[model samples]
Target: MTSTHADAHILVSMTYASRANPNVSATDFNEILQQAQINNAANSITGMLTFNKDYFLQTIEGPRAQINRLLYILISDERHHDLQIIDTRELKHREWAKWSMNYASPTEENAAIYLKYSTTIGFNPYLLNAESAHGLMNELSAQKG
Candidate 1:
């Protein structure tokens, strides 16, 4: 969903390096997303996660208290680190209907997009700059052919 200035939304974007666990495969990541959906559904929170080879970028928005609580858990979890809060403005409804964690394999094309936006905005796609993060999401969404 498109966010407007009038909406009350808090956009927290963060990225971190993957843990050095050999068993953390694609299936494990998928399971995390599944669990996130179940957990967030219970709390009325919605968000999305995007990951590449060694980085993760996610956004969660909902009631301030609920989102903050979830984020605390997420940040403290052993799975990720170097967390950065991108934007925490007020937004209306969620941009995604369900909690989804999407995986994107790094390619020249994807890397190029990340580099371009990172250079221009001073925030890596792995981190969070609203414009760059949203742009990368749009790019990935458009490529779901």
Candidate 2:
């Protein structure tokens, strides 16, 4: 017996972090966000992206195949490098189902929220536990509202 995309019905969530390419301009980041929202919504994916000047942290949930395809795209994208997957899990329901790709960039108003999830004042997803990473996104989402 073999499993295929049709046979894989489980929803999965993936959390990852990457160092942003220094040369990537605001226009480039906006384009990436726009593309991700369009692609994710079309594929029934939902997620949140958080970034600072130096890094990107994101959590995405969807069908296994779509998530895998996203991972592949992330690996090949030149806008960022040193991609690291922080966690992957089979999900019962999406944490951010309402968002195709909600985005957040740290501001002074929310700096404390980032600090709550990080060991230091700066936001660093690599240092975060899976639980904290999701918690951080949830908090950020609340702030967005």
Candidate 3:
């Protein structure tokens, strides 16, 4: 169920994880986000990425085919490892329509939200169930971009 502008398909939402690159600096992540923003905006993609010290959990939504392609690229990237998709579904509409790629990195100010929805205060998505993971993503999506 791929999509083009004219032959539009269902919105595909996916969540995936990878090991955080230990050496990558904040500047590097900002560069990555900058690139993501440009690419997502061009492709009409909307999603959020949550990064703690050890893992990354991201949920992306866009055309089915475009999502497929992006997944392929993500899997092939060497910056991280243990990459796996936790959820994928067809959506009638996008959940994060205003976001190109909203990055929600862990911080003291934002720790409470993660603590509330996550299994524990450590807030690791890798240990979360599909429902919890998606619930956390939904909460993140509602935040101001």
Please, what are the lDDT tens digits per residue for candidate 1 over residues 1-145? 2323342344433333333244457776777778887787776666667675445677666666666677778778665566766656566556665444444545656766556556544334544456667677657655643
Every model's TM-score: 0.67, 0.92, 0.86
lDDT of 2: 0.88
Off by over 4 Å in 3: 1-7, 118-121, 141-145
From the highest lDDT down, the ranking of the candidates is 2, 3, 1
lDDT string for model 2 (59-135, tens) is: 98998888888899899999999999989999998888888999998887888899888886667788988889888
Output the TM-score of candidate 3: 0.86
Better of 1 and 3 by lDDT: 3
> What value does the lDDT take at residue 117 in candidate 2?
86
Off by over 4 Å in 2: 1-5
- Any idea what lDDT model 3 has? 0.78
In model 1, the runs with Cα more than 4 Å from the true position are 1-23, 98-128
**Clashes per candidate (backbone, < 3 Å):** 5, 0, 0
Q: What is the C-alpha lDDT of each candidate?
A: 0.59, 0.88, 0.78
Candidate 1 accuracy as lDDT: 0.59
Candidate 3 lDDT, tens digit per residue, 1-145?
4346653567889988778778767776787788889999988788888877677898889987788888888887666678888888889988778789987876666667788766655767777766888777766656533
RMSD of 2: 2.5
